[model samples]
Target: MVVFFFVVGLEVRQEFAHGALRDSSRARLAAIAGVAGVAVPALVYVLVVGASGGEGLRGWGAVVGTDTAFMLGALAIVGPRLSGQLRVFLLTLTVVDDFLAVSIIGVFYSDEIRPVPLLVALGCLVALWLVGRSRQWSAAPYVGIVIVLWLATLSSGIHASLTGMIAGLLIPAYPTQRHKVVAARQLFRDFWQSPSASSARAVGRGLSKGVSVNERLHEYLRLPTALLVVPIFALANAGVDLGGGVVADSLGSPVTWGLIAGLVLGKLLGIGIATLLAVRMGAGRLPEGVGMGSVFGGAALSGIGFTVSLLVISLAFDSSSDLGRQATLGVLVAMVLATVLGWSIFKVAARRWGEETADLPMTLDSPVDPEVDHIRGPEDARLTLVEFVDFECEYCAHATGSWEDLHGRFGDDLRYVVRHLPHHPHGPLAARAAEAAAKQGMFWPWLDFVFTRQHALEREDLIGYAAELGLDVEAFIEDLDSDEVAARVQRDIASAEASGAKMTPTFFVDGCRMVGSYDARPLTEMLESSRRGGRTQAAKA
Candidate 1:
């Protein structure tokens, strides 16, 4: 159970770091919707079970959260085009709302409080927080503090799983570091030449340091936790017996019906209305590709309050007690109904609004120019991929490795374009340097060189690198500092902002912006889906 929650924590941490939550505008919209999602569910739970008195109201927190794993898995199955924005909203809401639900319930419902252990746990949390803020290289400190924190929390009256989640949250998340990749590969080369124990250990150490610890643990534990721990936990908790007429008794109980109403109907109303209200009131705009119909469909699916609901049930009532059993039945029923409701809403949305799953603002602000932009593959290709990048950005560097294969998949049918987005302090210099290389007809080669050697970006280094690229050094220097080159970089920056690109390596597949994972599989899927859509439109014409 602790392991499952830890994985959940890692997921939320990643989202905040590099995923959709990083965009404040996008996140704020989801956050506003999330607030209403929580409130309305509780309000519904109270209304349905209020007749049962104060004890029943305590179960309100149980309805406020949903199962993240189930919610996302179901979303993948839905597979609607241009629905990445919906993914972001649900992810932000679930992660934030779950934490609030658990923390609040833990505070309000625990039987006995242990201040000493809690204070010790608090100290560890503060330490972990500090470590996350620093540019720490090793995972040793994180692992050590988290273990101690877990033990202290176990002894405390507070739920220990909450500590696991907090520890995961406190760990920093970042995209792959290019320098570290190079260093790790070099270490492996050293080991290959001398296969001794010392060198082997060095290789292991290097590999661990190649990526941020937050990502390392998440990748390592995701499989086992998902396949084993979460499933086993679910089976253990969710497997209920009704052979002894317990179902008959539960049907008569307000707790059972209250949970159902709160999860299914309440979630749909709360999320859908809240998002609409927020957008209408000018608090935030919905993502472009997303529609209200899709939002409602997504909201309906948010009612699968599995793990947290079970945890809350235990916290609020004795597991063997009648109210607890009744609450359990309600949760199970809501899961079934939510799935049905989601499917129904999505179907209706598809028919009425031409919206299948979700939304995102994806149209490229500037059209591709074969003569002006650096391109790989045919300009008249059916698929267009545009990347907004800064040469100094490591994430952009990391992404270059995938482009060759991506272009290979579509051959002349896809054109890959790279545009400048000077999103960093050193980005402008790198862009100007690349523009200088363009003057020597070596723009593409210069990009490959500067990305690997981003650490050396001074004027002297740029000139030196330009010479290595077989360019006129003086001409390169002249162009590097030219007002014309600066203007070219500035133009790209303006286009990137106008296109709503908030980070380097933002991708547009067929003019629709792709968010979240930019790996080959997801990128390929988006490209293919868009290609098919384009063909269908053309055929209809």
Candidate 2:
């Protein structure tokens, strides 16, 4: 469990560094929704079980988590029809929910607090942080330290699994040094070009330093944790006996019904209603390609509280007691109902909205070609916003407002370029249409048109839009399938792949890659920080 949670921590770190949560503005909605989701379920548990006035009411935390593993596995059943935005939302929410659950356990469920061992654990964490900062290259030291930390934490009355989270967060999330990475790459190339054991060893060490520790751990542990550790955990914890008339008796108990209500109805209402309210109240907008129905379905899936719920049950009730058995039954029923309900809703949503071809996840080393790309600001600008976007993607459309604000505020200080990564079926056509319009010197306006009416970017619609823009319709139609235009869009796709973009509107500010936040203030702040860094480096030079 400790190893599993450590891996979870690693995943969270990676997400914050390079994935959807990098954009805090967009991530805020999901965080808020997660809070509401947890809050509602807890409230339901308290209300329903507390009304009956028994020890069974203590397991409120049981309804708070969506099994990260199960939720995703169920999501996979929906296949390519699942939008990237929904994926981001659910992933973000689950991670946050887990963190909250852990906090609750530490605060509310611990047996007895031990200050001495806890302080030792804290000291170990501090030492680990210090060692990591000083560039410790070997994993052996970390392994030994981790064992000691686990023992300390275990004896300290905190859940021992928390060491995983501590270790994962402490692991470096960035490369050691750019110069070392460059030198290591060169050496690795040297060894590959002319092989030898000595050079091979050097290259290995160099490559190790080139990647962050968290990333290495994540790569090493992801499969084992998912395939082996989590399953074993489920097998041990998920077995609940429904025989001996226990089911019938549990049916009448508030504890059993409360778990069902909290896990099924409370989670759905909390996440779904909170998201809807957030968007409607202008606190935040929903992610593109995600509709209310999809959000509701995803929220339903969030109710599938399996492993974590079981943990809470064990903590809240004596395992051999009637209350414990009843709560156990409730968790099982809730899991079954939530799975069925979520799957049914998502299947309906998939049919209504249609599946979009998802973008392949790529690395961040993709080449940028500002020279051949469409530019919207001065060439000599200090900050550049390189956006890899799908014309029909609603998130991209939402970002247009931010881009406009950026352009208005920064003017020539910021250079903007749009790159096409058409993953959807209609996406290639839309990209070519925009390219065709670019030939007619109406690329920006045509882009505005396509984004404004993103759902109507088909072949016929593209031609109509071109004609509406007063372009030579014949030339525009011919250019739509032109080899040159097709190649250009493909080039952008290639660049996008190289850059590790798995979703629309992947933005890069001064070569720093970020995904999905369209808030003007943060965008501006990032731009300013980049500009300052550049100026500082120039002055030093």
Candidate 3:
């Protein structure tokens, strides 16, 4: 169990450090839902079981967790529309959900708590934290200290599995600095130039040091933990005998029904209601490819609590007891029910939504102007969006919010072409700086950085960004003022003039020009229209 949770801990660290949870705005909805999912289920358990004023009231923790592994597997069974951002949202939610469950166990389920060993465990954690923040890269010392912490925690009467969570949190997540990476690359280049065994070893060591310890541990432990540790725990714990009168006894138990109501009804109401209120109140918007019905479906699916619930069950009731058997039975039954209910709801809702939106109007026009050069998209894309943008244009800067969404949502289906107008005083310099960054395969990032800090696109700012991106600072400065790059910017301006775009942030969907700044929804609709039109053409052919 400790080993299995250790792997789960590593994943949690990974997400917070570099994955979807890194963006608070994106993960906010999920975090809310997870908390609600836990809180509301416990409330429902209390309502249903607390009414009896018996041992059934002890089972509140049984419904506070979602088995992420089971939920993701069930999502796969349901189909692809359940993927993308919604999947990310759910994954993050489960991470939070499971963390809460573990914490609950540590706080509420432990026996014979000892302050001294617990404090020692905490001190070990602090040591790990300090080592993580320091320049130390070796894993041996961290491992030894963590083992001692685990033993100390075990002696302290805390759930030993918590050591995994603590250790995982302390693992370093960020990569080495850009300068270090660049220096390593330089060393490797030098080594290649000279071709010695020692230089090759140095290069290898440098390269290895560039990656974070968290990522390194994750890569090593993920497969073993999943295949061996988790399965072993499941095999050991999931063997509840349902023979003879055990089923009947379980059915008759209030504890069983409490678990059921909490898992099935409580989760559904909690997640669904909370999500609707959040979205309505502007606390959060639904993830992409998800609607109200999908939310309800996901809420239903969130009831599929297995592994974590089992741990909670063990803590809540002795395994040899009738209450424990009943709770386990309820968990198994709830998982099946949740899977079926959620799957059915999602499929019907997705189908209805798809049919409703199937006839979205076609906004297709001619192919993009091949003469204009700056582009980002797949070569064989059927649709293109061209932007005639000025670096200092406020509208253009605001318009990036929509463009970013379009780029992410449409990906390779819609090609994005950038053309410079250079209308503002600093526009020419910004455009030239972008062109120079393009020489170093960093045009898009440079463009994003420029817009993000549009007011700070001075020469020094451009030079600073160049240095930040590990570009040849001298070459970038030279190119920023060169006649060739200047001509390129002028040519794009001329092309925009030929297209009759007088504004700063003019856009063309293919060749059907749309002037001024727009929102993501309309742009999304246009892209969808263009895509459908292409498919229609193919069908005719």
Candidate 4:
């Protein structure tokens, strides 16, 4: 009970602080996608079970599960062939999908309620909160208290594990004093002056000294829950015994059929319909170099229901019943099938799209644009560093400082070029904001803002940051809404593909690609080597 509550609390905090639900649109879309994915499968399961007169009809809801880890892992294996935008889209969709699945279990699957036990559960929660408030209790006492809460909740006919989620939300998770101080300082500079400024400064100072503490914590607490607890739960619960009649029964049963149909058929339909509607309505466009087929394929993969399905089944059915067994089998089979189909479709679709052609050798006789010439120089003192980066990529945000360092060190001698490779669907807006900042000659500052708040990079946040930077917010928004920005982003993506810069934060010094993260030492080595080579070539000439 303790662990589960802890995890749940953490997740709630994190979602508010950094996870997908922070973005209203992304969250809404994810909710929609998740609902369609779950509802279709569930409906199918119930119908099939009812038709066959099978026993697991009550457990139909268990069929709508999504294995984000497995799906993302599979996408990773598929490599750069899959568009970055699609990957981000899948991630956002899955996070919300998980949340919805959990809610369904909590609301619908609880046993018959007795008011006495429920009241006791609330009392226990209050006690636990008071204990947590002290911040002095050892982990042992908390664990024991949690166990008690779980038992109480279990006896109360409420799902016992829900105690974990409830407990997790009630706990406090605040950022360090240093971060608070930094935030205060930034806010003060951006917003207030005079008496307000003085007050803000005082608050900042207090935060710096770790003297003042805010009772309400910022939302990043969910990271621990999602990263730690969710995975553990998955590992513990997902190992089903596939031997004997279990396999046959799962295939033959309505529960299995419904799950399969919902996942395989519903996911694609929902995502496809939504995306098509968005595009048709002029709300969004297909990502550059990404086809409808690949998008559909990725959506199909969204049907991979492993972790949530198992959790739901556990909650909804008694262990001794045939319903539980059927639910388990259905989940496993549907997940396996979804994975295979999605992967195959993506692989074939990506191959058909052809390798990114930007990096290929070009004939010397090819005409060069004057603007391209203006940006290029052959001098050894001048360094041309091109970055293929996604605005929504966390890793890219992390590496933003490294680029800043290079800029500070090299100044005018370095020509840093940014090319868009928006990895997630939300990235394009961020990319547009950066471009808008570029129009106002504040691109770097805007870049800093977006990267620092990457976890909170919603469209409104992007626009708000632009406003904070003193850019014309309306114009910036209009530009983002324009196809011109998207075109520029696409050109950059094609250029990146040509240069073999497949991942975000990919750096090319001259023409040599640098993949993944690197500190000052390696960066310096690469730069120096490039300089030496350029000098040697000059000497030969």
The candidate that achieves the highest lDDT relative to the unseen native structure = 1
Residue 43: error of model 1 in Å?
A: 1.4
Per TM-score, the best of the predicted structures is 1
Residue-level lDDT for 435 in candidate 4: 74
Considering TM-score, where higher is better, how would the candidates rank from best to worst?
1, 3, 2, 4
**How much lDDT does each candidate structure score?**
0.81, 0.78, 0.76, 0.61
- RMSD to the native, candidate 4? 11.2
Question: For model 1, what is the error of residue 8's alpha carbon versus the real structure, in angstroms, after optimal superposition?
Answer: 2.8
lDDT of 1 by residue, 1-541 (tens): 6677777788888988888787787778888878788899999999999987867777888898888888877776663654566776778878777777666665776657799999999999999989888867688898899889988887888877777888888888887776788788899999999889999999898888778889988888899987898788777777667767779989998889999999999999998998888888888777656788888888998999998788788878865677788898999999989988887888888999888546534557778877678887777888888888877776672345777768678888888888998867788888899998898888888877787787777778888898788999888888888999999888888778777686878888876777668777777877887788853332112
Candidate 2: which stretches are off by over 4 Å? 78-80, 135-137, 175-182, 348-541
The true-versus-predicted C-alpha distance at residue 456 of model 3, in Å, is 13
- How far in Å is the alpha carbon of 270 misplaced in model 3? 1.3
Residues 95-146 of candidate 2 have per-residue lDDT tens digits of 7777777767667777787999999999889988998898787676777788
lDDT of 3 by residue, 65-142 (tens): 888777878876763432544566777878888888777877888878899999999999999999988956667777
Candidate 3, pairs of clashing residues: none
Query: What TM-score does each of the candidates earn?
Result: 0.79, 0.67, 0.69, 0.58
